[model samples]
Target: MSSPDRCPVVHFDHHSPEHAADPVGAYRKLRAEHPVAWTEAHGGYWVLSDYESVFEAARDDYTFSSARTSYGGEGLSVTIPKTPMHLHIPIEIDPPDFRKYRKLVNLITAPAAVERMLDMISHYTTWFIDRVIEAGEADFAEIIGVPSIVTIDWLGLPVEEWSRYSSAHRATLSAVADSPEFRQAVEVDLPYLSKQMWEVIAERRLNPADDVISFLVQQQVDDRPLTDEEVFAIVDLLISGGVGTTASLVGQTLVWLYQNPDVRLRIKDDPGLLDRAIEEFLRYFSPTQALARTVTKDVEFRGCPMRTGDRVLLAWGSANRDEAGGFENPDALDIDRWPNRHTAFGVGLHRCAGSHLGRAMARSLIGQILERMPDYEIDLDGLVPYARQGVNIGFHKIPARFTPGPRRLPRDDRSG
Candidate 1:
């Protein structure tokens, strides 16, 4: 057992160029040598790379808090190098109050509710594909427009502004905080989004609609109704969640399928195998890589002294690939891996409420591609990956070519 002051230390920076270059290789090294090592980056924190350590820490919310700032109290944010942004309700708030916000969000995003949107998800996916099918080649990263439209439509925001949101978010997540791209997103794009959201929120207050905005405006917390700030925060969180990660997974999976024609052929021949394949992809190429939690008290965790307010990064990507976690040939992408308990959507009370929706959307987007562009070939040399993979691993551009095809349905047809 290592003493509090004599624990293993490593100079690991998740946002560094080295990490972005080869994330899995970097994490694999950490898991093998120092699963629970201390790092001096981002004002210092512990990186939990092993499956058991991350799983246990995530479930023990009381000890490892997610609060950006405790409800009505002073605390640290979830991110190691906390971003200057609105509170991500439910995720950045601990239980009790966390449940209140989570429950409200869940009311609309539950599995059954997402099931209701499968056709809609498929419709948008097909529509996006239609735009590119005739061209014979496309920048596949533009598939993000599907989720952007779906998310804004769900929130009752103007769907035409989907590209703005998608591009801004992609920029924000792909760059380090100090980078010019990140600055542009934070200073320019986010403010515009907030303004637009506020306007819609005001409109929803007077004339409610059958959408999330109206639903949120009428909800109450504790004995009183939620304020405008609270409403904005929740809505912002939803947009952030809805727009980015699923699309990242889709992009990564597309690249993987292009490289593995055998797996692609199998999935195309039997659509039933897709869900399992998506699971394996999720485990293998975790989009949302690591999320941070603040230690609540002084204690020894995984044989290291964790003082109060110390940031601990739970490396979900590493955990999924942990061989000791019972994942045989952990580095390989096994589409048939059953009972796969990967933490891609995280674990415990703070597990993503939109997991069902994300999975369904991935299904529709990727399934449509396999069906429509069965012989598509990626331009690997032209691929442009994200400059940073600290929080998410994704591509900025995935250029590909396939045989041209006719549109399956009219653009304006909801039932198409």
Candidate 2:
């Protein structure tokens, strides 16, 4: 056995282009060799690559704290090198305190709320699809990125500035961590978006509207109206959570479907199978890659000694592909696979609160794409995936071509 003081270590760069291109293969190798390996990247940390370990760690909040500033006097920001502007609510806070903030935003993304947005989602999806249906070619990311912004706008932000905020959000997703572009997004773009949200908050306070911003402004916590900071935090969380990730899923799903015509035909023939197919896609291509948790106590997990203040990465993508994690033929795309308990939306208390919204958006968008542009073919040579795949895996561009189709919208409806 390896000495407890000197555990086996491996140098795995999760952010490299090679890993980003084929994260599943990279993680599969790691899972086979070192299911719990210590990496030297980002000032050294433990990486849990197997499903059992990752799931367990996510559940044990006491052992693996989610706080950016943990009780052990160390910052446990989810991203490596840490984010410059790190004030994401609920996700960044631990239990007891996490419950209040989570409750505030839960209703916004609950099933009923998301169900109500379906007609709006379908409208926006059709509107965007109509723009490219007659073009014969378009970048799928650019085409699909707008609807989420429109959804957020309806939720009580400025719809007119959707382009600006959406661009900022997309830039942040595509850029490498701490890069100039990423830094600009964090320091400049996000603050500007926050300012806009604050203005909306001010307006909602006086002239309340039937929107999320107005609802948030009127919400009380502990017998007091939620403070400006709390409200801002919630809105920021909504903007960040709702914008790019759903688009990424839809875009990536398109890329996958275009490549696998057999699976595409299966879903196309049987529309009822699309939901299960979406779940399989989520399991296969876990968009939000790995989330960080700080070790709160000294513990020996899988023979690796974890000290307090140590940051451990729970590789959710790896867990979804684990062969022993309850799924048969883990790597294969089995759309009919039932009881898929994948960690695509994460697990335990911090499972993505926007899961309902994300699912609805993805289903609505992809369904519209299949219906309108069923013959669309991806330009394999023109595909461009994001360079970094640590926090979020998404496409920079996915160019595609299709037979020209008639515009679904009337000329009057086209004029925005």
Candidate 3:
């Protein structure tokens, strides 16, 4: 057994182009050799590649703190290298205080609330498909517009500006850190998004409406109503959380389905099969791949020495594919895989609150593609995936061709 001072170390950078290209192969090798290997990348951290370590660390939030209280404090930020942006509430804040903000968020995105929005999700899905039905081609990544529109519309932001927010967010996640695209997203695009959010917040303060923004503006935290900063943090987190996640999953799954016409036909023939297929795809793609946490104290975890203020990354993507995660053929996609408890969404308290909404969005968007564009074919040469796969994985563009079809818009809803 390795002592606290001399645990195994490895060279690993999750955002590296090589890992992005073959993340599964990279993780498989690491997990096989050292499930709890230490790495000196991004100021040094540990990577938990196996299922058990990742799942337990996520559950034990006290030992693995998520709070990013200060730049020079014991508290560590969730993202490696830390972000220049404001702290994301709930996720970045720990329990007790975390639960306070999460309560409000949960109410906003509860399963029932998301169920109520299914019609809207379907409508927007139809609208986007209508745009390209006649042309028989689409940059399929644009389907992200569906979730983008629903999220902003639910937040009571201008529904029409969904494309701007989604585009900026896509660029931000898809680009390499400090690159021109990244700078544009952070300095230029994010500022625009924040400005728009704050504007609506101001409007809701005086003229509160029946929307998430108004609901948040009127809510309390720590015995007082939320401040502008707090409100922005929450709203920003929602947009950041909702915009790219489901869209990425849907985009990747679409590509997979195109390559696996047998599975695609099976899903189209039996609509019920899509739910299980989605679960399998979630495991395979793991759109929200891994998340970072700060070790709270000096301790030996999984036989490795981890000190207070040390950083650790729980590789949810790797965990999903971990052989011991109790799935048959762990590396392959199995729509029929039963009782699949994948950690595509992080486990424990921070397990994505918007999971139901995300699933619903995927069902509407991908289901429509399989139904409307049944014979869609991807332009493999034109496909563009994100350059870096840090915390999220997504495609920049996926050009596709399908037989031309008529717009399926409702007669009275021809506003698109």
For each candidate in turn, the TM-score is 0.95, 0.94, 0.95
Q: Write the per-residue lDDT of candidate 2 for residues 294-358, one digit (tens) a residue.
A: 88889998888888878788999999999889988998988888889999999999999999888
Candidate 2 lowest-lDDT run of ten: 70-79
Model 3, TM vs. native: 0.95
Local distance difference test, per candidate?
0.85, 0.81, 0.86
Prediction 2 global C-alpha lDDT: 0.81
**Tens-place lDDT digits, model 3, residues 1-416:** 22246369887899888888988899999999999998877767889999999999999999999888543233227767666666678889889689999999999889999988889888888888888899998899985578998888888988878878877776665578688888888889889878888899999999999889899999998789999889888888888789998999999999999999999999998889988888999999999888888888888998888888788899999999987998778978888988899999789999998899999999998888999999999998898888988778878889999999998886467432
Query: What TM-score does prediction 1 earn?
Result: 0.95
The per-prediction CA RMSD against the true structure, in angstroms, equals 2.9, 2.7, 2.6
What TM-score does candidate 2 get on C-alpha atoms? Answer: 0.94
